[model samples]
Target: MKNVTSLASGAVTALVLSLGLAGGAAAEDFEWPRLLVIGTPGTSSGSFASTNGWGPILQKETGTTVRIVPEDSETQRYRRLTDREDIAISSVSASEMRYQIQGIDGYSQTKPVAQRILWHHNDTPWGYVVAGDSPVKSVQDIKNGGVRITQGVFSPPMVSAVTVGLPAMLGMSEDEVAEKIEFVPASSYAENCRSVVEGKSDIAYCSPISSVLSEMEGAPGSIRWLDLDPSDKEGWNAYLAERPMLIPAEIEMGVKTARGVNGATSNFVYSVPATADVDFAYNMAKWFHESFDAYKGTHPLATRMSMDQFRKYLNRTPLPVHEGTVKYLREIGQWSDEDDTWNNKAIETMDAWIAARQEALKAAQEQGIEVNFENQEFLDLMKEKTAGVENFQSRL
Candidate 1:
C-alpha cells in the first residue's frame, strides 16, 4: 500500500510538469501583437474604405491583431489618444504631434502629454478646390483682388491661415488676395463638396490625392482642383529644407483632372509618416517602403510607392532619421556617414533656436513688453521650425 501511494504521487507530479512545458511551448509560438489603429472615418463616396485603408494593409503586413477605430474629427482623435495613453494612433499630422509634445494650443492649456511617433507615411498637400464651372483658374486668380474663397473648418482653416501668412510675407493681405473668401464650417469633406456643388460655396480646401478629391472628381462638374504652381520653388524649397518629409509631388494626369488643362504636372507638398522609436519606426517604415509593391493589387496608388520617390521624400525632411529606418537606408546604400553628420548638426541648430526663442519670449513677457505679437511670431516660427521634429518624436 505504501509503494502504491508513492507511485501515484510521482505520476501526478510528472503529469503536472508535462502540462507546464506544453503551455510554455504554446506561449512561445504565439507571434501577434495587439495593435490599435485610429484614423479619420471613411466615407461612402471616398476611397478610404475599411478594406483599402492603411489599417488593413498594416495588419496584413505585420500579422498582428489590429483594431481600427475611426474618429469623427481630428481633434477628437487626438484627445482620445492623448487622454488614454494605452491606445496607439496613426494618421496624425506633424503639427498636431508638435502641439501634443510641446503642450501648445488647447493641449498646452489642457494637459501635458507625451507620445511616440512610429513612422511618417506621406506629406499631404492642402488643395484649393472649386467647382468645375467656376471662373477661378489659378492661385493668382483667387488673389486678383476680390475672389471669394471658402475654407473648411478644421485642418483646412489651419493650413489656409498659414498660407495666408505666406502671402503676407510676400506682400499681400487676406482681403487683397481673397477679397470675398469666407470660411464655411462644414462637418466633413463630403459636406464641403456638397456646399460647392450647391453653389453655397466657391472653393474648398482639401488634399488633392485624398478620398474626398477622388469622390469630387467622379461627381462631374461638381468639383475641380486649382493647381498651385511649383514656381514658388525657392520658397517651397526653403520650406522643404526645414521639412524633409515633404516632397515636391506632381499630381499626375488622370489622378485629379483631365489632360490639356495644365499639360504639365502640378507641384505640391506630400505628407509622410514619422516616428521617434528608431528601431520600431524604422522597421515599420522599411516594411512599408520596401513592400509597397505587395500592395499594388490593393490600390493603384500603391504603384507610386517607389524607392526613388521614397529617397526624394526623405531629402525633403531630413529630421533625425528613425534608427530603424536609417538601418534599412544604410543597408540599401541610400544613406551615408555624411548624412548622419548633417542630421546631427541640423538637430543641434534647431534645439538652440527653440531654446533661445523660448527664453526671449519669457523675458519679454516679464518686462511687460506687449509680447502678444512676439508670441504669435514665435509660435509661427516654431510651427515652421519643428514641423518635422514632432513627427519624428511620435514614432519613438
Candidate 2:
C-alpha cells in the first residue's frame, strides 16, 4: 500500500511538469498570419528599401509571408489602407499623418482616418536644393528674392503649403514669401524636384536619399542643398511655430548629395488603422523591436531605425501610439508613467479635434455654407469652433 501511494504521487508530478513545459513553449511560439501586406513609398525611395529589408526576416522567423506595395504619395497610400483590406500596414511622414488625422489639405474632402503609430521608422532630412553653381547658399537667400520655388499644382495641397510655410522659419510671413519668391507650377512631386535640375526652376524641396536627387547630382548643372542653420535658435523657433511637429536633425545618413548638412525632418513612421487586431499589432511591434539588429544594416537609413531612435520620438509623433504597442512597451518595462500621461493627452486632443470638426460641419450644413477646406468661411468656422479646445490648430 505504501509503495502504491508513492508511485501515484510520482506520476502526478510528472504530468504537471509536462503540462507546464508545453505551456511555456506555446507562449514562445507566436502564431503569425500566413500573409501580411505592407504599403510604402515608391521603389526608388528609402522607405521601400527599409521595408523590403525586414520583410524577409519577419517571414522566415514567424512563418508569415510579407508583401510590399509601393505608392507615390500619402493620399494614394491612405486610400489603399482604407479601401483595401489586404494592406495591413503603411508608412507615412509626420506631416502627412497630421493632415490625414485633421482631414486638412488633400484629406479635406474626406473624413479623417483613425490611424495609430507602430513605430518611428526613420528621419530623412529635407531642404531646398538648387544648381551646384547657383549663388543661393542659405534659406535666407531665397527670402531675399529672385528664386523660383515650386508651387505644387498637384492634388496634394499640403505639398504647396510646406514650401510656402517654410519661409516662416526665417521670420518671413506668407505675404512676404508671396512678394519675394517666384512661385512656379509643378504638377507632381517628381516635377517639383526635377524643376531645379532641368533649369526650369531655381529651387525645389529635396530629400537626400531620393533617387531623383542622384540624377540631379549627376546632371550637367549638378545640385546643391540650402540648409537651415540649426545654430539660429530664433529661426528654428519660428519654424517650429509654423510646423511644430518637424524636428531639426543633423544630416548623418542619406545620399551623397545630402551629406554634411542640417535640415528639418519630420519623423517617418509605420502605422496601421485603428481597426487592426490588437494581438497582431502587439506581436508585430514586439517582434520588430526584438529583431532590430537582424535588419538594421539592410540600408543606410535602416541603421537609423534603432530602439533608441524609436523611443526618442515616441511621444512627439502627431498621432497617438497604438494600444497594442503600448501594451508591448509596458511588458518590456520601456513605458513610464510620464509616457502614459502624454499618450492620454494626445488621445484627448485628437478627440477634441474630431468633435470640433463634426460640430463645424453640422453648423455649415445647416447654414448652407460650402463645407470644404478650400472655402475660407468653412476654415474660419473650424478655427472659431475649435478655439476652446486645448492645443487645437488647423495645421498640415
Q: Which candidate tops TM-score?
A: 2
What is the number of residue pairs that collide in model 2? 0
Tens digits of per-residue lDDT for model 1, 240-268? 32332333445453444632232121111
Q: Which residue pairs does candidate 2 place in steric collision?
A: none
Q: Candidate 1 overall Cα lDDT vs. reference?
A: 0.47
- Candidate 2's C-alpha runs over 4 A off are 1-30, 34-52, 65-87, 105-113, 131-134, 141-163, 173-180, 183-203, 215-223, 231-234, 240-245, 274-279, 297-301, 330-338, 357-396
TM-score, per-candidate, Cα-based: 0.56, 0.70
Error of 1 at 267 (Å): 15
Could you tell me the lDDT of residue 114 within candidate 1?
Answer: 37
Model 1, runs deviating above 4 Å: 1-91, 109-118, 122-125, 153-159, 162-170, 174-191, 194-202, 209-224, 233-248, 252-255, 258-282, 296-309, 336-342, 349-396
TM-score of 1: 0.56
Q: For residues 1-396, what per-residue lDDT tens digits would candidate 2 score against the true structure?
A: 000000012233311110111211232565566557788989998789989998898888888667787888778778767544446788887767777767666575456557788877888677778888878877788778887887667734335445645776667776887788887888887888898878788878767777788888898868888877877877776666656667776666556767888876767888887756666778878887888899887776776677778776764554678888888889888888988887787778877777877788788889988877798888887778878765422122
